[model samples]
Target: MSAMLRKWVLWLLGLYFVGGSGAALAALPIEHWTQPDGARVYLVRNDTLPMLDVRIEVDGGSRRDPAALAGLAAATAMMLGRGVGPHGGQPALDENALVEAWADLGAQWAATATLDRLSITLRTLTRPDLLERAVALAARQLAAPAFDAAVWARERDRLIAAWREAQTQPDTLARRRYAQAVYRGHPYGVEATPDTWSAIDPAAMRAFYRRHARACDARITLVGAIGREQAEVIATRLLAGWAAHGCEPLPAVPEVAPLERSQDVRLPFPGAAQAHILVGRPGIARRDPDYLPLLLANHIFGGGGFTSRLMREIREQRGLTYGVFSHFLAGRHAGAFTVALQTKPDQADLAVELVRESLRRFTVEGPTDEEIAAAKASLINGFALRLDSNRKVLDQVAAVAWSDLPLDELDTWTARLAAIDRETLLRAWRRVIDPERLVTVVVGGQP
Candidate 1:
């Protein structure tokens, strides 16, 4: 790649990692209901567009992965379109036929797994003919996926090769080492290796799907030109026969454990021109009480791009690296609070020291009143961008459902931020962050 293109890509990555947005639109009216089968639904009707987006959040993330088969949940989700079993009048359709079926309808369907949720989403026009068929096809995949052994073999080999290639990267190595130190003995730290992929067969994927993909435990979010009544029918259809009626709920998964002490690990990667450094520990969950205040505080800390303190100190002032950022990976379990950067191999120590010092000072003194005001203004003003499209709105609605937040969370977002002053932010920051216990991992030229 050319130097100019490399710089542009790095800039985009920096902006994405330093994440925050503003809101300038009117309040969104979110409608909520529960189906007879115990599935909860949230709807945001936007008749301005003819497109509909349906998202289903299931508790089939890596958290539910059997220790021996770390990638089963994800593998099952990835193979949803590989095939679907015969049901009602439709014959069994293989992977290619499934793809052609969706192509015929001019709609899209996909399932993806993350740390805490396995999401299945579809996009189709609001026309009755297309929408009805789209819902039926998605239901088939949900009710009875084929989990073909031949497909799994090919996918497993491809994934193993991809993972092995990624491990050779300095950034990937740094992230792995940091996760190990921060989330030791926690499912949140679980990563699928080549051996784990080898161990996960089609049977294991089927078992994982059956155990976790139940309608009773689902949060279905719909955003489109559809009313509550139409959405209800669509949601019920998509989740039809997801699980048997009288089955008992699965056992609750354990929460992520907090780090007992700080760890400093340096991984040797000779000839690495740019060193990667990560400092992190177990942070907050989605339902954290002080989530709003902490969100603003994180923006000022490192989440806000060039205007953030980390950028000003590490890159702008001393020029240690092109970028530095702090982010909270909040989810169902406590995700890590991470501050990361890349710099020259020789300057890794200085970069690490500066990041540590920034954390210490922020935890102690907190952000100033001016900083708080700036962060709120920046975030609130740009929040509307987050919901500019149907897909983005679906994402916000799905997150609200997954986190069990109030239906009016998006409407009252700016009001909540406006109410938070310096004292509230400072108190929340101090409670959430403790620099003394942060784990530091550096992957660079020297050990």
Candidate 2:
């Protein structure tokens, strides 16, 4: 094997053995500091590779968009990397020039919008000159997006087309309607329809960017072969010039009310060979005390792939569907627990009933001690793969910072997983999972 491939293999094997020991990996010594402009910064120094990864998460996403303009925050995030004219005396940089500059420095950058935050990520070689240049370019993009009129018009059209196309997909439609039914009048339920996209004017997007993407609400995480001093310098350069804004606090996410009864909705799709099934209800938030237990419980119930009860019962035993799985989303606020699967249209009803039964059984009896132990073993041992690289580590760091999770959570993850007993798992399941309250949406012909 080539040297690089051989090195990676050995590295993975080493992590696997570490996981097998049931020992938590030592946490990265995360250094926390605040930028002059009030951006929160978290850094971890790992000189194992000559690379740097930076992620900036602002407390603004779809949840913050005006109800009338559901896609505004998403559109704003999409426009951040496009181009920016001179602002506060800085020179202009068009989208192409900005991209070429990063290419010249052997770096890359991208942005994404989510339910709770908008994240902008950058990666580059850890050489001081390259890192500095990349950070400066990112800062400019974040601080002064041009929101060019022509570009906004084109992007608006593209977004509308994409939404229209998505409406034709059964799985997409099922998931969207499921969220709407579950959240019901909550901001989380608001989806971007064609009208939402069409209403997205450049002026509104620019205003939303300025209001929500300020340094005051930004959480920055950096992982690289750099020292504390260098990391601080990079962060300052990236955030110092942005003026802080006194934006209104984010609206509190209302508690998701339990379903009064099981609701089933079916939408017919012409010539659909399979039915898309979504079963779920409101779940816990990231900081919920039951989060860990729910996570462990989910693995045995459905999130563990073929090893899960749902998959075993529905697919392997009954042959109801090819795949079935469940997961808790754990967002900034109370999120969702979703079980998704697909089967022949004629078998849709049976599949739904089987899913409900699986959930009922799992919650009522919970997983056995052996099952819990096995689940914990699998989850703990597999986690090392998540921190196998600088980029992956950076992603974890960003998650912790943005979610306001404890700094040592990553270091203690395996130990925490190993510590959960069967009782704890059962208690979490009883408190969180409710099959009777699930809202089911199936898209296809009736069975």
Candidate 3:
């Protein structure tokens, strides 16, 4: 094999043997710095392989979409890599040209939009020349997006069609209605309906990009075979000319008030054999003190696969459905805790009641000592998988940067899990979860 290929193989083996251990993985050092233009940078130096992963996250995501333009943030993110204006009086680069430029250097790039941030990630070999070129290309994309009208028209139509197609699916309908029920007048509840899409023209998209994608709001996370000094230089160069102009700070997410009473809504789906049910309510933010405890508690409650109470009681014993699972999607602001299930339409009502009972039991009685120990063991042991590679570590680092979490959060994860006892778990569950106020949405049948 080539030398690069052999190096990669050995690196993979080392990660499997060394990073596979929870303690060793957590001990990896992370460095932090800031650029002159006010962009924050986080770095982890891993010289195991000759590759680098860079992510630029801005505080602009779907939640920032204007009231009239529901999909504006997503559209802006997608357009960033489509085309760029002429740099230094040179010719412009279109989407295909941009792809070819990266391909020639064995690099890859992508853009993603979430509720709280828009992230652009680039991965390239760490050879000085290749790294320099990749950084220049990314800078162009971020600083001088063309927002071509032709490209916007085509992509907009495609997005609208995808939304229309999703509307026909039972699960999608249930999720949309569930968001509406849980978030009611909040931005989190907004979805890209047909009318919302109609209001998003090219000009509006350009305006949204300018108003949200500012350097001041950016956070950079670099991982792989690079040092602290090189990372600082790279970050500064990549963001040199980018500035915050006409940019507005993201509005604070409103507090999610508890529901006064339980709400249930059912929608019809013609000829669907199975029912899609969603039970949930507003959940905690990522920064909440009870986040970790609730996470561990939920694992025993429903997120532990077959080992969880919901799976064992609702599926293994009673055979009400093929699968049942629950999750808490903690965002920058308040998020959602949801239990989702699919079952034959005939068993819909019983399945809903069973799920409700299971939640109530979990909330009131809390997890047993045995259940808690098993959950702690599973979570603590499995965390090594989350840091097995530079890519995974970069993702965690980016999340910490964007969410303003403690830099040592990953290092202390196992210790925190170990500290949760029966009382702690019960207190967190009682404080954050209220089974009586959950909103339920059933699609494809009446429950």
Q: Write the per-residue lDDT of candidate 1 for residues 193-305, one digit (tens) a residue.
A: 99998999888887788778888889999988899989988988888867553345877877777677889999888778899999988889999988899899999999999
User: Residue 426 of model 2: what lDDT?
Assistant: 87
RMSD of each: 7.3, 3.2, 3.5
lDDT of 2 by residue, 164-222 (tens): 88878888889888998888877788898788888888899877877787777889898
TM-score of 1: 0.93
The residue pairs that clash in candidate 1, if any, are 22-382, 22-383, 22-384, 23-380, 23-382, 23-383, 23-384
Instruction: Report lDDT (CA) for all predictions.
Output: 0.85, 0.82, 0.83
Instruction: List TM-score per model, in order.
Output: 0.93, 0.93, 0.93
Model number with the top lDDT: 1
User: Of the candidates numbered 1 and 2, which has the greater TM-score value?
Assistant: 2
lDDT agreement of model 3 with the native: 0.83
lDDT, candidate 3, 1-447, per-residue tens: 765345544543333333222433324577887776778999988787899999988878888888888878888888887888787566799988988988898998888788888888999999999989988888777778888988888888898899889877899989989998998867778887778877887788777777766667889999988898899888887776566453466667677666778899988898888999999888899999999999999999999999999999989999988889999988877788999999888888888899899988888888889999889888876776787788998988888888889988876677677777899889988887888988999999853
Ranking by lDDT: 1, 3, 2
